[model samples]
Target chain A: MRDVYVIGAGTTRFGELWERSFRDIGIEAGIKAINDSGITGNDIDALYIGNMSAGAFINQEHVGALIADYVGLAGSLHIPATRVEAAGASGALAFKEAYLSISSGMYDIVVVGGAEKMTDIGDEMANYITSMAIDQEWETVFGATYASLQAMMARAHMERYGTTREQLGMVSVINHRHGALNPDAQFQREIKLETVLKSGYVAEPLRVFDMAPLSDGAAALVLASGDVARKYTDRPVKVKAIGQASDTISLHDRREICTMDSTVYAAKRAYDMAGMGPEDIDVAEVYDSSTIAEIMAIEDLGFFPKGEGGKAVEDEKIALGGEIPINTSGGLKARGHPVGATGVAQIVEIVKQLRGDADRRQVKDAKIGLAHAVGGSGATAVVSILEAEI
Target chain B: MNMPRFWREKQGRYNLVGNRCTNCGTYYFPKRDICPKCHRKSIGKMEEVRFKGTGKVVSWTIVHDAHPDYKDMRPYIMAIIELEEGPRLTGQIVDCSLDEIHTGMRVRDTFRKLSEDGKDGVIFYGYKFRPVKE
Candidate 1:
């Protein structure tokens, strides 16, 4: 296969988008990406839309076709719309597939994005939609939701690795600080660690602050073959590698809970394919579905030693200018995880950092970036390694 | 659908019966088709082993919001309790206040209904724990 590069990326502000429909929101971002890439709608060979629970949230399915139709690319060309679904990793997986198809020379250019209009359904209905990620047969079958699942995982991590509640709070405080600087972040206010610690519980170990808010947004990325990347933009973030893996659907079926094996396996593969290690990565965008998930990703991705991830945050090791900057884009904690849009949003942040477009959140002299997205209870994981140059 | 039968199958077993991989010594809760640790198909029949239920709270959160089906039970404590045997389990914290929970606090096992799928569906019951009183 040939190489693929990201030439343009765009995302709308993430928050409670009360007015925009899913199609309109998606079209806006897609058009922005197309404009940024200097490519018209005709230049796109295929479209990949990552969406989760459009049926549940909006009472609409066939989102891929809906996006294609709304964007005015349906009839003239066989713009086959492929809808990707892997819980929260839907967008990242969509990007991954589009990148592969382009790299393989099947498509010259691919427009990839995700959209979610969760706020329309109300929080209660939205919560049910998000709960689809868990084991419906056993876990959710028993009425346990993702909050309860993460709470259990948090409890287990603390017990097994001596992970402190304070450490978990550190993730929230740091992300909120970064979120304060993020113009598009939903929760753009810096919060104190004490505040998080004292926050009301959402689950035993996960506080309200520890969780990402219910968000509605859309994000888009334009991918082209390496040969055609220069025709689109002067600066192309090369897609070095894309790695994805899945653990058992049932949390109880997994071999270990404390360690997210899916993340470790996927990250390892991505790093190996990119011919780099954690030390070579200058910036990272990890899935912080909850604060504890972010902490676990830090260790699982090999940024820090086992059991030292929480402490690393306390030492300011994950700050914007620290040893390894993580989630400079405010992360899911503050960035607002819009489920379907979150993974694509992650890629957008990394692309911005690599293009030197991120003003305050920029990591100095950043060369390589990695984005990690995980599904429920660590059952599914996708790791993408991107570089400034091939 | 019967509460007693479901409880008997889970809590009545006494032991937190799970699958243990003889090849790699990794234990799996709720059993597994194959040993994930060793990737070996030849796995011994792991038996029911009662945990001290006494483990440390790995992490926890108090859920203020609840699903529509569970709205009445909002603001409940859910936790991941790491058993001394090295497996972590998710359960509700009973007989303790939200303030009583802390990371690494010692806990002992109890069984309770996590949730019911529907009125006619199963009333799921499983092991949970509370802080072990000194």
Candidate 2:
């Protein structure tokens, strides 16, 4: 297989996008990525869209066809457009498919995008739809919300690893601080750790601040073969490796609730394929659906040893200028998690940092970056490694 | 959300029934056709097994934010119970307060009403856990 590279990336400002339809925001992000890559619609070979639930959110399905037609890539162009759904990891899975297509020599110029319009359905229905990602027959039927599931994991982590509430609060504090520097971030204001601590409990041990808001947005990336990547941009972020894995859907089915085995497996595969260890990664973005999740992800991804992730955050090791900066785009916590859009958004942030385009939140001398996306309670995880073309 | 889907799992939901892989002695809750450990080899070797309702709370959460269906049950205690039969399952910890639930606390299953679709709709019943009072 040949090498793949990200030529361009773009994302919409994440928040309650009241006016834009799902297809509209998706087209906007795609067009921006095309423009950023200096490529026209005619240059695209195929399109892949990552979407969790446009059907439930907007009562629309066949989103790939809708987006393709809206972006003027359908009919005459008749591009092979497909939609990938793995709940929250939809975006990363789309990227992985696009990468494989390009690497297989079947397609050279591919556009991978993720979009979700969650606010349209109202919070209650939207949340109910989101809960479909869990075990529908068992977990969801018993009233297990995502926050409550993660809260249980947090409780287990606290009980076994001695992870403190203060440590859990630190994840939100750091991410919000970075979000304050990001122009497109939803909550672009710094919040205190005390704010997270004193926030009303969404689930015991997990506060409202611990959760990522229901957001509506889109993100897109233009990928090309390594040979053709530099033709689009002088500096292309090379896709060193891509890895994905899945586990039992229910949290109870997992051998250990505190550890996301999917993340560990996926990250291990990505690192092996990249021939690089965790220490080689200069920057990273791990899924932070909740503050506790960020802690678990860092450890599961091998960034910090098991049970040490919390203390590492407490020591500012995950801060922007600290030992290995994480979630510089403010993460899902403050950057806004539009479910499907999040995986691609994480990639967009990494590409910006690699290109030296992220002004204030840029990590110094960033050479390699990793983006991790999780689908439903750690059942699915996708890890991608990107290196600056030196 | 369909009646048949719930009805189909009534055996397990009501009696804590599961399947044990006779070949490997591994147990599974919500019985599966094939054992995850032995895969296709253990397909015909699976046997029905019932767990003793008794267990310990492995982890739990007092859910304040809940689904639309469970809005009335806000701040309800949900927990992961490690059953005596070596299988784990999720259920609400009833007959207890938030302050009373913790990891390692002993508990046992009790049949209770899960939720109703509407005021006049089907009232789904399933097993829930309560503190194993000494």
Candidate 3:
């Protein structure tokens, strides 16, 4: 296999986009990415879309075909289009497919997009739909909601490792601090640890402030084979490696719930492929669907030892200028997690940081970055590593 | 879920029946066909093994937010119970207050109403946990 390069990226403002239609925002982002890459629609060989549940959100299926049709790449243009789904990790998986196609010489240029319009439905139905990511027959059937699942993880992590509520709250506080600088972030304001602690309990050990809000947004990336990347853009972010893994979808099925095995395995694979270690990553965007998740991810990804993530947070080691700055994009918490779109948006943020375009949240002299996306309660995880010129 | 799907899994739900790989002796709940570790060798060797309906709470949470359907059950305790048979489960811990729960607390299964689709829909019944008699 050969190398793949991300030539351009485009993303929409994330929040409850009640006025924007899913297809319209998707097409808008696609057009932006295409324009950024200096590539016409005719130059695209294939289209891959990462979407979690358009059927539940917008009552639309065949999202890939819908996008292809709306973007005017159908009929005579007639490009092959496919949709990839893996709950929250949908975007990264879709990006992986696009990268593999280019690396394998299957397609030279491809447009990979991740979009979700979750605000169309009410909060009650939206919360229920997100719970579908876990085992319905076993977990959800017994009142194991998505928040409840993470809550259990928090309880266990606290019990076994002494991870405090204050420690978990630091994740929200720090991310919100970064989110304040993010132009497209939803909750673009700083929050205090007290704000997280005083918030109502969605589940014990997890307050409302600890969770990422439901959002509607889209993100698109234009990828080209290494051979022709320079023809499109000078600031090409090389796709150094992509790693993905899946474990038992149900939290109880796994022997442990405090740490996600999927992230550990996926990070390992990516690190191996990239020929680097955690110390080498200058910047990272981790799966922070909730506060505890960010804590657990940093540990499981080998950034810090297991059970020490709490200390890391308390020590302010994860800040922008601190060691291995995480979630400079505001994370899913403040950036607004539009689920499937989160993974792709993470890559977009990394590209900006590497290309020296991330204005306020830029990590100085950054050359390598990592994006970690998780599906459900630690079921699926995809870790992608990207690099720029040293 | 639809009626047929719930009906098919009713046996395991009610009895807390887990399947073990005869080849490797690994147990799984909501019983699956293949053994992840043993792979092809354990395909036909999987057998149902009924749990004693008793376990210790490995972790727990008091749910304050739930869908409208589970409104009455809001603020209830949900826990991860590790059974003697080795497969863990997620369920509500009943007949106990939030302060009464902790890790390693002994509990036993009780058959109860899980949920209903809607006012006109099917009612699903399954095993939930209650504090075990010392």
The DockQ of each candidate is 0.35, 0.85, 0.85
- Writing each residue's lDDT as its tens digit, candidate 2 over A1-390 gives 999999989998999989988988999999999899998988999999999999899999999999999999998899999999999999999999999999999999999999999998778788788888999888988888888899999999998899999999999999999999999898999998889999999989899999999999999999999889878789999999998999999999998999999999999999999999899999999999998899999999898999999999999999999999999999999999999999999999999999999999999989999999999999999999999995
Q: Which ten contiguous residues of candidate 3 chain A have the minimum total lDDT? A: A248-257
lDDT-wise, the better of 2 and 3 is: 2
Instruction: Give per-residue CA lDDT, model 3, range A292-314, as digits (tens).
Output: 99999999999999999999999
Each candidate's root-mean-square deviation in Å?
A: 4.2, 0.8, 1.1
Q: In model 3, what lDDT does residue A91 have?
A: 95
**Model 1, span A1-390: residue lDDT tens:** 899999989998899988888888899899888888999887889999988789989899999999999889996776888999888999999999898888777999999988888899777778878988886644553446887777767777787777898989989899988888899998889988889989887766678888888998999999999889998788899999999999988665566767899999999999899999999999999999888788889999999997888889888899888999899989998989989989999999999998888998888888899999987778889999998862
| lDDT tens readout by residue for model 1, B4-114 | 545645632345676666666666565555765555453454444545567777666676666776666766666656777777666667788878877677888776655
Model 2's alpha-carbon lDDT is 0.93
Best by TM-score: 2
lDDT for A337 in candidate 2 is 93
- Ordered list by TM-score, greatest first: 2, 3, 1
Question: CA lDDT of A84 in candidate 2?
Answer: 99
Off by over 4 Å in 3: none
Worst 10 residues of 1 chain A by lDDT: A135-144
DockQ of 1: 0.35
TM-score computed on alpha carbons, candidate 2: 0.99
Which pairs, if any, clash in model 2? none
Q: How big is the positional error of residue A293 in model 3, measured in Å on the Cα after superposition?
A: 0.4
